[model samples]
Target: MDRSKRRFVQALGATAAMASLSVSALAARRTTWDLLIVGAGTAGLPAAIFAAGRGRHVLLVDAAPQIGGTMHLSSGQMSAAGTRLQRSQGIIDTPQEHFDDLMRISRGTIDQTIARLAVGEAAETFDWLMSVGFEPLAGHPVSGLAHEPYSKPRYYWGARGARSILEALGPLVDRGVAAGRIDLLLEHRVVELTTSRRGAVTGVAAQDAGGARRELRARNVLLTAGGYASNAAMFEKLSGIPKFVDHSYAYSQGQGLELGESVGGYVRGAEKYLANFGVILASEAQPAPLLARADFYPERRPPWEIYVNAHGRRFIREDMQSVDAREQSLRLQPLMRHWVVFDQSVAERAPPLIVDWEKEDMLAAFDSGAAYFYKADSIDALAGAAGLPPRELAATIEAYNYGVQTGNDFLGRRHLPVPLAKPPFYAIRHQGVSITSTAGLAVDGELRVIRRDGAPVDNLYAAGEILGSGATQGQAFCGGMMVTPAITFGRLLGQRL
Candidate 1:
């Protein structure tokens, strides 16, 4: 059968299913909502709240019982220009500057249209948050934070983590529920989509926790279900890149993307993959999960040591201002993993390698070897235990020591000019890890889901991480692109659509 025929059959079956069920069964066996939103997260939640507040009946479904999704762990950093906060703080900025800085930071890799729209309305969204009682940290709206500095001071975060945004959204969600404008079906994962003969999405087939399948029909089907960061297999397949580590929201399984594609939506933007600079961790295994950070802001706190790959060579300036440069380099590595090597003298003389670790905790980790803590009488012995070539490792150390003593570094490592000529050398294996993906579905200015052919899928919409970080932020992380856009687009759709 043709594409239209297949959709006709599916639509007919869904219509019959809807009609055969009794009222309570129709209400419980299956549901009909004005708008069916998959993934009640930062994007999905705000969408539900805004749509339902507009008196449109909305049904919110999530695979996880909780609603926050990745926002629970997000930093909640955001960028916006010309906001009320900016006015109050006397921080001068403009949407044009925001757009220019975003493109500049991403090096024109981002979809300019999407970036333009996002930056244009971002200031309004920021003001909305302030009106809703969201407070920023002191001296917020700064030029930038961990990401590269923007041209203006327009970046800020809630004093709390991502939950701060959720907290601001929670009451609106509850109000929607109390007003009977929105129905939340938690623990239900969308598996299939039912479309009309014209290839327009009409409803979704979701499975509840009890292994029960139900149909939800709607005039509009929106997918804010997030990205495939948690699903390693799908992540690799979609992006054509190996998942170096598993470090995303466990429930972000690319469900919405899969369902949308099943109907007609096309996925794109896999070409923009980038990895985090480096991660201090406890293992060299496949999910080289993060344990701590090797933050190199010497002005605040100096780096206790340096990093080397499997070849035993430094790969970074170790003091570069460009997080993008650092991340792009790390992604080029074979498995997105690196090792941090230091000597006992540096370990004893400098601050602890793990920033948050108390002196007792550091000593315990060293004693326990939980984070590849190894002690040896010599550098070669430490290399042996750390599974690195002793000769090459020794040579690398020699060069580093020469740089430290002679003040002529090869890697331009500013701090830790001390030589590693002391006994009991230490090496902690660090890896590259991130909670976001550079690959995702391609979306247009209106946030409509599109096909690989550059055509919009009628009545199908996608937002949030499902659209991929690469499409919006490009190869670089722009602080709040992930959460802010998710929330912004979700709200925009709710009010407009």
Candidate 2:
């Protein structure tokens, strides 16, 4: 679907939307709103609902036509200790434990005050989600999946992933709209946060689809607009890392960070540059989002083929139990890149290595002569074709085959079911990819946008990735930290602000 027309407009209730601005509302559009919530996604929607239900006239605007922002693509996994879901599952956990695990995952390089705030409030948000008909995936509330595992069963999402959370939120938003509390400005982009002469945020200046600009006023403005993922320039500038893969939602263009920074907001946590390893780049000559990726999670699927760096030496144990350890080990490799080198025997014998992919399809990729995937008759040829050192590649295979015969693997690899013995060989090159940047607008416990001096910008609040994952998940993808902190912060702001 064309994103321009995709879910662009919120279905109108009896109450008029922003485009249809009633005469009375228009006359006061520049001054009447009590709260202006920008970017109606996970955090934005909740802030709108909770604040509007409290008798505050709200203006909810999003650049995209639809309501759910990243929900369309988000895996939507979430976690909160001591929730009703955990109680029902007979899982014992606490916010303190969650906080400790999160800090351990980030190695204490996170915003402790903000982490405390989110984890303590997350259980209430989870209970509220359940009360609103948000059902969990069967046998969910499990420890973990793609990322690191929690100590107890506290992770879950609906069958539809982010759509499940969106479903639970739709009714609450509709109720607010029906009661004339929320005036949703779908397809309207908030370009700037309008502020006062003394540097206090007063409202937002937005532009609509037809290129018309409007300065709408509100007593309180939520800086929940967009993250930096979709904007390459800002992403590189703030993240200090080139976008190796373009997998973020297109709407996450960092408009919120831009607007906030245009004022007094500054970014932080850039030192936490962590990479998600094993992304098969779309182009071997030049880095791109994908061809596809090898899930390569030892917890889910043990390795059949070995992983080797550009030097053609094994870099990992291939069966590391901890996801964090694997990611850290990957960081030490050349540009965090490696190739999956295997022979015909492993290709036909071992289970498929990539998720949601078949062996033939992978072979087809190799046959296509894509630079990222290669098919060769010899180890030296495979190395030359896949950009690895020829001698090193051949020696690496010999060492591995020797280990396979002696039953004493060099790299502590127990999953050596197949060695590189067959004549026809294959190599799949992969570079690390990051979905979200670890750097973003730094804010305090109140969710107020802050400056470099640790001073808060009044009435200017931010949630979601706008705060950066480093603040929430730290350098590691702590289980469910993104969605959970986003909701918890937005909820906290709506209730107390």
Candidate 3:
């Protein structure tokens, strides 16, 4: 391995070793605990910490070998109004304003009850995270980055991303384990939810890596087991789309959703599914690994190329400022995919198309015969190579050049730097995919997993991605909506239950 990779592996090993010191063996001391958290992740960690802090005997179980869940891969972006940090920075805000901004950005698709509950307690969550040594980036609390901007400067993230948040929570969990309040089980997956004859959830039946099964009892069971983005079958079944990308936590196999549904709970928000604008895939395989991301955000890099759909039609203005508008437009394209088409002059002069990639590296992709990069001496040949209609692509390029000459662009695009008239045309395939599950278990305002009749399943609650991205952010990619709500709800449930 290279030096950097070897160092990373060594650091990861050391971290796991230290974390293992805080974990209790798989032996449960009590037959019935006060609470059982089904995932020791972003939501489960806080839930276990606070629940144990309340002197509740808590059993924390996870399918993964360690804790922190999706936070391990998350950007760790968080948004909360009326935070002490915002006040200290002299920026005024409120949860009501946060709610309004979310509704505006999501176009009223979010669950109002859940959204309110999340925003209402988000400040406390952020403040607590800050008090525990979670540091935000310098000059943070900006309006936004890749998502729709909030009205106030409420967005923040740590310099080290989610690991910063995990570092803050790890010590508290160790204290809980040391005090004999929290019992943690790693490499144990909850296979079934044990229920009373009355249909109230009593506990969970978990299986270890060795397939040894054990039934533990608890008065309350909370599912913070994350989403199904990693499970292709479940992703298609729930979101009604092929899982086009393999970019989620491996343990996020929708087991929590299944466990919730098996015990009389229902799932919803399938219609609210939305994929990201687009990403370059490493291969042509279904659910391919992400190769690199193009700088589609016009603010960051004004487009010098035109984006065309499968039919070789320009779907939207390439220079559109709103990221949400771009994402929604991409959602309507064929298979949620598009191609960035440009000519030799634009390719040489435009800023690097791929984020953090050198222009020469991008040119090398075409020479190496990469799956998504296409290059040809003519537009017709390029279209054939990129799987676009030759005649339509030629016509589209002709019209685009005409617009450039006359300055009367049909799509009202303002950043038309050059025409696609130069030879050796190029196209890069971009696929729209989501890294988080959109459909989630049905839950009431109290976060209790509810039936189709809207009644809560007794002793069963859900938080985090198990509640679905749609539940909190609606049909839009609201910044920090998933992570913040997951942490906030986990905290609230931990304190209350």
Candidate 4:
């Protein structure tokens, strides 16, 4: 070993000795592992399984009391080209085409190397899912869902949100452990790294659930510890943006980001923070919900009326077909905040404003002023009570009425190609909210974590949301991008790295 490696080994030894001394008068013992995988979530579990299959002694540790990580809450949509299942189903696709679609949608923001690695190897990993009896939602592996449409039918989702993906992998993990190829240490949190003087990782010092410190040496370490979305302070510090809401996995506290940085891995992908549009019913002051979502994505239910701001003016092409188009338009506004303004005519004839609310609940919202409802004889009085400038709202209503009479509109809104001429007008406040962050850690094509100085930290790797959605999806959420890339990259790391 070189001088640096020797120093790292010695330092680790001393730390272990100190830990033992602090605990009791017991002698220090050493445990060695061919591969030490941190986290037992979506990415880490597969790594453990694949490494164990290679006959390597593996130690899998997680901070959570259980496994499954963020996969427990994710939508778990997957994408690929030329999957074996697709071949058998008479579907045709190529990785090259998949690569082209990602680039075209991302508009060159994604790292080409990582994108290529993921797209090129995606189908095989997807095929592996089939070998394990992984099933998809009926009518899935279609062209796309809500985001940009795919060039070919390459997207698939599990039946239940993310559980379907986890169920398929759980049996494989159990098999690995039964064969003695893998040892799992749950409720164990890695605190610090034991490194050699040359900065090579020698081992990690961790505290178990019972608060006992232990040291273990390993030849390599893989960090699949999701992201910092659940950690507000770290999320703000790393991405320069405050946590908008707490809808992500609670265990995603960004422990891996801290651990990686402590060992000389610098952060990347912070530049890709993009929030999705139309997160309904969130208050301006806090995260989480004070009210449930209004479910305004017109594709789910055709928009019955126009949406507006607090000023009661139309702000978008209400008939636009693309969710991406709508979300991107919302992102351009401040805080993604807006309001849905309609009238009594819409209230009576249009679909319910809220998904499950009945006439009674809707009336209650109006009575309590939780939602805006004004019974004014004229449009100007309605606008004033709704807190909008009377003239602007009146002019807007008049223009809308003219369109209904003339059979033509400048905005081309087909759903309510009619006027809001009625007894009362209504409005509901909303804010732009997102469950996923676009910003994430930077990785090379091989998925190795790199330092700020642009040097690869050997034997260190990261996959899944730890790398951030923004790095791969860019400013807009391309459909199937976040969950798919996460799982695809996880599979790639396990089988190859």
Using lDDT as the measure, name the better of candidate 1 and candidate 4.
1
* Number of backbone-clashing residue pairs for each candidate, in the order shown: 0, 5, 0, 3
lDDT of candidate 1 at residue 203, scale 0 to 100:
88
Stretches off by above 4 angstroms in model 2 are: 1-30, 283-289
Order the numbered candidates by TM-score, best leading. 3, 2, 1, 4
The Cα error of candidate 1 at residue 87, in Å, is 1.2
User: Where does candidate 1 have its weakest 10-residue lDDT segment?
Assistant: 9-18
Winner of 2 and 4 under TM-score: 2
Q: How close is candidate 1 to the true structure, as a TM-score?
A: 0.90
**lDDT tens per residue, model 2, 34-68:** 88888888888888889887888888887875677
Candidate 4 residues 435-462, lDDT tens each?
7655566677788878887787777888
Segments in model 4 whose C-alpha atoms lie over 4 Å from true places:
1-30, 209-211, 237-241, 282-285, 295-300, 310-312, 353-399
Best by lDDT: 3
The digit string of per-residue lDDT tens for model 1 on 1-497 reads 24432232121121222222222334863356778898888788878888997989888777775677787777889888889888987787898887788788898888888777778888888888878778889888887758777888888898787878877777677667556676666667888888889888888888866778988898888898888887888877765666656668889888777787787677777777776766666565655566777655555666657677787777876666666777777777756667778877787787766667765676677678785666788878888887778888899889888888877889887775578888878787666666676666666789888877778877778878888888779878887777778888888988877
Question: What TM-score against the true fold does each predicted structure earn?
Answer: 0.90, 0.93, 0.96, 0.86
lDDT tens string, model 3, 193-293?
A: 99999999999999876787888899999999999999999999887889989989999999999999999998899999999999999998988999999
